[model samples]
Target: MKLSAHVEKVPLIHPFHITGYTFTHNDLLVVKLQDGTHVGVGEALGVYYKHDTPYTMLEQVEALRPTLEHGITRKELLELLPPGGARHAIDAALWDLEAKQRDMPVWQLAGMEPPRPLLTTFTLGADEPEVMATEARGFEGVRAIKLKLTDDALNAERVRAVRAACPDAWMMIDANQGFTRETLASVLPAFVEARVAVVEQPFPVGKEDWLDGLDCPIPIALDESIQDHRDLGLAVGRAQVINIKLDKCGGLTEALILAHKAQEMGFKLMVGNMGGSSWSMAPGFVIGSLCTVVDLDGPIYLSADRTPAVSYHDGHIWCPETVWGGPVAA
Candidate 1:
């Protein structure tokens, strides 16, 4: 097998803002593995909050050159790389390579039922309340809208602005580990008042315990708090929703098992992304089929997407097998 990867800096249409970060472009790690005549590709945007950059992700993948060249399986990969973007890119490439080798699709390999178009949430970055409201209105009645929020006192006002702009669209918010116990409490009423569907990562990662006995009506979803399946135990009594991101869990291999086990453990599932290109969102789209909430809109943020891309249509994200993890590579 021949392993090669590069950093592709894809510019974003707009500067993307969350609680602790701002991005003008996504520096993606695109990994390609060649076995015989077949080539497989995977894209990854490393976890930003962890200070993961394309160079760091590339270094991690390069460190596993010997193992990958010698041929590694997804299950074996779990033992090798701790969960993060490097492992995710490699694992996804391996899955794609194996799928092509077997002349089948990844969903079939995973024994999942055939996938269909799923309603995916479009995100509005943290901005002036009116700016967010304007962006929310631009979605033109999107089925779901996910808002980026901060710890500021104006969070409730931001929620209300978007709600007023798109009264019919279902709403969710992600503070991206921005809030404290006190600020969260102050904002909880606004979330409920605006009828926000879920409040994601409102409190910082280690502050999940603050949720204990807090009277909140909105479902609390965990993002930064839950990485791979091993972290599920932390959310058992703390959060109602578990968000799975490929970059955090390793890749589709772990994400599939994580989602299944999370569901069995009685948590609502969410599949999210790290703002890679459409290729990065492809694998997540498969997991999205099983999730109650989907936020795989990374490609839409990109200034340009690769050919055979995952597309958004009719307020849904559609990933054709040709986009990834099939006999034909994207």
Candidate 2:
């Protein structure tokens, strides 16, 4: 096997803002693993909060070229890398490679039923009340919208405006750890009134216990707080849903492990994206079959997507077998 990696810059259609960072482009790391007969490709946007840059991911993967060329199994690869983008890219490529090498789909290997088209949530970055409302209204045929929120007075106004704009759409908010105990409490009334389905990472990581005081009605979701299976213990009473991002949890290898454990503990599952082209979103698309909420809208935010890419229609995302995991599209 041969290991190769490079950086691919994907411009975002609009500025993407969360708690403390804004993205205008995705500097992704694309990795390829090959055995003379076939080649497999994978991509990762890297985790922004943890500073997992493309170059860093590249260096991390490159350092293991010797061992990778010697051919490493997915489970062994897990111990060689921590849960992040470097591992995510390689892990995904391996899945793709194995799927073709064995003439099987990644989902079948993962013990999942045939993949189905999934309803995905189109996300809107943080903006003014009216601006966000306009953005939400602009999404034709997209019935689920995930609103990016911040720690401020306007968070409530933002949700209220969007809810009014798309009254019948399913609404969810991801604070990206922007709220404090007080701020989350302050926004609870408007969130409830707006019929917001869930509030994600309302309080920053390590403050999972903040929900102890407020009898909040909207269910909370844990994103940044739970990176992998090891962190599942932190979500017991803090959140009702766990947003699994391949970039954060490494890739499908760890994601499947995390999802199973999260489900067994009674937490609803959500598969999300860090930000990349269809190559990155495809793996999560497979995970979507087992998830209650799917947020693989990364390609929707990009200026352009790869060929044979995943498609968005009506209110769902469809990935063909030629796009990603098992023969490409998982």
Candidate 3:
């Protein structure tokens, strides 16, 4: 087998601002693995928050070239690298390569049911209340909307504006670890009143224990707080849901394990993304089959998508038949 990677800086349709930072373009690391005539592809967005960059991923992949060339298995890859963007890219590529070799979809290889079109939540980045409201109005027919909030004074105002504009839409809030304890306490009631279904990572990562005895009307979903299976125990009594991102947890293998573990511990599951084109979102879509809330809208944020892109319509994303994991056509 042979491995190679390159970074593609694709522009976003708009400046995407969350709680911590803004993205004008997504710097994606595209990894390719080849065995004779067959080629497999994977994508990763090594964002600064995770301390991953395309160069870092490339170095990691290059370091493991010997093992990869000697033909490493998915399980072995998990131990070969720690969880993050680098492992995610190689793991996804291995899955793709295996699927191509077997002439089947990756879901089948993973013993999962066939992928189905799932309703996904579109995101409204942190912005002015009116700006968020306008964006919400544009997605009037979307079934669910995920609002990005911050520790700003107008956090409630932004939620209210979106709720008013799309009164019937199911709303979820992602603070991206922006709120302080005091702010979180103050915002809880407003969130419940606005009919927000879930509040994600309101408190910073290290402050997860703060939720231990606090009464939160709406469920809190942890993103940064929960990385792998080890963190599941820490969130048991605190958060009701865990947002699983393939990039954060490394790859689909660990994600599957974490999802099952989270389920066993009586927690609802959500599958999110790190923002890229369809190549980046394909794996998340496969994992979305087992999740309660699916937020695989990364491709929708891009100015353009990869060829044979995953199909999305009416707020639902269809599994790609042309690439990655899905049942092959007869």
Candidate 4:
């Protein structure tokens, strides 16, 4: 086996702004593994909030190259690194490589059902109420829209605008840890009025206890608060959904475990991304099959994607047959 890695800066169709940061481009670390004539690829976007960058991921991958080249099993790989972008890249590549080696898809290898087209939520980044409404109006055939919000005075106004623009679409909100207890309390009425189905990470991580006994109109999802299985207890009664991102919890390997545990605990599942191109979204598409709400729109935000990209239609994304982990003819 051989190991190599490189970086690619993927430009976004529009500027993406969350709580404290804005992104015009995503710097991704792409890893490749080769064994004779067969090759597998994976991508990781080590975003700043996660305390990781493309450079750090590349360094981590290079440091593990010796053990990887010499040969390492997937089980061993998990123990070799902690959960994060670097592990996600290597783990995804291993899954791809193993699937190709067996002449089967990664889904089959993982005992998962075949992939199907899923309705993905298009994102409306934080902006003026009118601008967000205009953006919402611009999208056609969208079934769900995820609205990014801040603790600003216009939070309710933004949701109202989007809901007015896309009256028929399901609305979700993500505060990205931008809200406080008081702010969230003040916004609950508006969320109920706007018919927002889900609200993600309204308050910062440590402040999750603020929701311990409070009645929330919509299902509150924990993103930053839940990293892996260990954080499951933190959201037991506080949040109704857990947003699983491969980059945050390592990769598909750990994500599957987290998903199962989340289900066992009676928590709804949501698979999301940190934002990247198609390569970064491929593994997430598989995870989406096991989720209730799918948000694999990372590639949709990119200006360009790899050839033979994941297909999108009527707000639903179809996993490309040519990409990693396929339902190839048996």
Candidate 5:
């Protein structure tokens, strides 16, 4: 078997900013595993918010040369590395390889009875409220739209614009850990008035307990606040929803497990993304089928993606043929 990796810096068509900072480009790690016959590929985008950089993720993968060259099992792969971008890329490639090897779909091997179509949240990038609202109103068949919010004082105006643009749209907001208690309190009322469905990770992780039992008008979602399945125990009662990002939870293996656990705990599920090409959206596409809200619009941000890019024909993303690779779209 042979293992190889490289990084692709994908420039966002438009600069993307949340509350914290603006990201102009994403460094993606692409890995290829082959046994001198079939080839399997996967990718992960470097996430700055998680303290992850392309250089760091590359070093981590290089350090795992021994394991990669040894034909490591997926379970051993999990035990060998802590959850992050590197494992996510490699694990996904392995799943793709295994499915191709057996001539079956990856979902079939994972024990998912039948694959179903998924509805994903159309994300309105960080921009003025009126501009974001214009983008939201243009979307078709998207049951939910997650707006990226910031610490700026104009949050109320932004919410108002979006609500006015899509009065009937099921709306949600993600602060990306960009708000304070006072600021969040001030905006929660406006968000509720605008019928914003849920607010996500308004504060940083540890401080999230501040909202525990506070009873805000809208439900709160935990994004950066929750890490892995272990973190679930601490967040179970505190958060109304869990935004599961495969890169954050390790890979699809842990993501599925965490989703099941979150479901059992009565928390709503929201599959999210960190931004990449179509490849980055593949794993999340499968997970979105089982979640209440889906935020897998990572591919849409890229200038160009791998062939057969996850087709977003209405508001639904099609995953008939892996979507990451395998066949080119006609």
Candidate 6:
């Protein structure tokens, strides 16, 4: 087997605004593993928020090439690479390769019931109220909306504007750890007022204890706070949900573990992404089967994406065989 990677910069259809900055493009790490005539593909987006870049992923992959080139399985690959973009790209490609090799679909390989169409949440990035509302209005079949938030007074105004524009759409919000303890208390009423279903990681990481003593009007979902199993114990009775990203939790190997652990603790589950094409979204689609909310809209944001884009119709996304390596019954 031969291991290789390349980066592709795919521009977003519009500016993606967050608390402190705007992202115009996604830097994707595309990986390929070839053995003779068969080749498998995978993708990952270097997330700046996590200090992951194309260069950093490349460095890590290069150091592990000796191992990957010598016939590595997806399970072994997880042990070799740390949980992040690089491992995610490699792990996903291996799953694709294995499915092709076995002449069976990924869902079958995992012993999962075939995937039905999935209802995914559309995200409204943190921005000026009116602009965010305008953007929200343009999308069709968006039953659920996840609004981005900041630690500012205007947070309520933004939520209100989006709610007004999307009155029938269910709402959730992610602060991406932008809030302080004081600000969180102040915004709790607004979140409840807006009827926001889940408030995600409002405060910074490692502040899990702050959430333990207080009562929130809305349930909190852990994103940055729940990276691995080590953090799951502290999350007991602390958070109501855990947002599991395959990349953030290393890959499906650990993500599956984290999901079950969070479930045993009675926390709702949400499966999210790092933003990329269908190639990147496929792995998370498996995890979404067990989640309350799915955010696999990464490919939809791109101006162009890999062929056979995941079919998201009427707010429901269906993963296709061309992208997944084998046909699956719905």
Per-residue alpha-carbon lDDT of candidate 1 for residues 1-330, written as tens digits (9 for 90 to 100): 999999988899999888767899989999999998998898898887887777899999999899889988889999998888998999889888888999999888888889999899999999999999999888744889999998677899999999999888888999998887788888888888899999898777787788888777889999999998988998988899999999998899999989989999999999999898778988898788889999988988889998888878878988988889887644
- lDDT per residue for candidate 2 within 84-189, as digits (tens), equals 9999999999999998888888899899999999999999999899999998888879799999998777988899899999999998999888888778878888
lDDT of 5 by residue, 284-305 (tens): 8777778888888887777878
lDDT of 1 at 121: 93
**What TM-score, over all chains together, does every model reach?**
0.97, 0.97, 0.97, 0.97, 0.94, 0.95
**In model 2, what is the error at residue 51, expressed in angstroms?**
1.2
User: Candidate 3 on 1-330: residue-level lDDT in tens?
Assistant: 998888888999899888879889888888888988667788988646868887898889888888888898889988889888888999888888878777888888888998889989999999999999998888735889999998789998998999999888889999999987789888777888899999898888788878878777888899988888888987978988999998889999899999999999999999999898898899998889999999988887788898888877887888675857543345
Worst 10 residues of 2 by lDDT: 321-330
Pairs of residues clashing in candidate 4: none
Model 3 regions lying over 4 Å from their true place = 326-330
lDDT of each: 0.89, 0.90, 0.86, 0.88, 0.81, 0.82
Superposed Cα deviation of residue 288, candidate 5 (Å): 1.6
RMSD of each: 1.4, 1.6, 1.5, 1.4, 2.2, 2.0
Better of 2 and 3 by lDDT: 2
What residue runs in model 1 are displaced by over 4 Å at the alpha carbon?
none
Off-target runs (Cα >4 Å) in candidate 6 are 325-330
Model 4 stretches with alpha carbons more than 4 Å out: 327-330
lDDT, candidate 4, at 52 = 82
